[model samples]
Target: MTDRHDHPAAFVDDMSDRAEQIADAAMRLFARYGFKRTAVDDIAKEARIAKATIYLHFKGKDDILRATLQLLGQRVDALCREVMEMKAPFAERLMALLRAHHCTAFLSIGAGDHFAELRAVIDDIAVKERKAFESIFVRYATQLIEECEARGEITLKRPGVDPAALITTLMQASVGAKVGGISYEDYEARLGLFAGVIIAAVLP
Candidate 1:
């Protein structure tokens, strides 16, 4: 007789794998021509499968998007966790995680006239998603800040810099670099210096 736990576990694993594949396909298509212009047909073609097959897995295009964004959120959490697990200095781990997020995932997905609609969706979804991301970033950043203070890497006289403000600054800087056409090499150099400065500023 088949063990009930074994069957359920296998079924869940298979579903997760399939969902991930679908998300990957959706990302590629959406990246090519913004999510608004991409159709289920486009995703189906990219995935090399029938449109009906997509329906079997997801409710529709919106469902596909929800899944893709959710996957990204999970990945961000995992990256933060990895950085936190590193034995190096807290500042080093934070820099590594910041650098990882600096690169844009879907280059072709631009704002253009699609900004309003997309922004609305993101704002609503992000209200929830951003909190989760912030929790991860703050947890890691706070630990690093504490470590740096103990080692005299920073000289914070009081509470020092807010972790949320630091994360926002780094994110804005990266976005500005992307907008200004900064080369990867230049961005990396600048990011390193910026990270170091932030560490020093917050260290007490």
Candidate 2:
């Protein structure tokens, strides 16, 4: 019979830290070598952990990928919140938000062939998480639009243009610009221009 009390209070914390280290190593490998080519042994070697130790934290490669995506999602969410809380004007804040999002996406997927490989590896999970995140993002954008309008920061040129629809279009355009081969700094500048156009279109 083993005594569970033999383990120190830091045992669980240590395990969690080890799990994060493993996930970080896996992310680097996934970025450098495509997910299919990155084996558990490779991750273990990168993290300097025994191959069996990975099992203590993750079921397998798929599970590790899921964990890494979740971490990425949390970081994006935090960035969004930070931008939303800024003291800048609505247009400036919106531009900042779009820039943060695009920059984060580029960093996450633009390194080597990570995006294509990620799409191939966990398409379903990726789609589900993306849709969920986008839904929340759109809602927040709508709220910002409404607040801006109320504050006279913007006024709709066409009263028929639904705030939600306009926000969705802006979000899609921002993403499309990135996929269309524009450089990061250029994309960011375009985001500022886009936000200005949006505000101009709605200005009284």
Cα lDDT listed for each candidate: 0.65, 0.74
**Model 2 accuracy (lDDT, Cα):** 0.74
Q: What lDDT does candidate 1 reach at residue 99?
A: 53
Model 1 TM-score relative to the real fold: 0.73
* Count of clashing residue pairs in every prediction: 5, 1
- 185, model 2: CA deviation in Å? 2.4
lDDT per residue as tens, model 1, 1-204: 885477998988877877877877886666556677889999888878788878878998878877766676677667667776778865677677775444332232222334344436655654565355445555666666666667777656756466667767776565444444445667667677778878777654
Alpha carbon lDDT of residue 22, candidate 2?
A: 90
Candidate 2 — worst ten consecutive residues by lDDT sum? Answer: 108-117
lDDT of 2 by residue, 1-204 (tens): 855457766677788789888988887888778788899999999999999999999999988988776666677778888887888788777777776665676566544545555656667555666665566567667767787888888776586766876787787776655555456677677667777877777767
TM-scores for every predicted model: 0.73, 0.78
RMSD values, in order shown: 4.1, 3.5
Give the local distance difference test score of model 1: 0.65
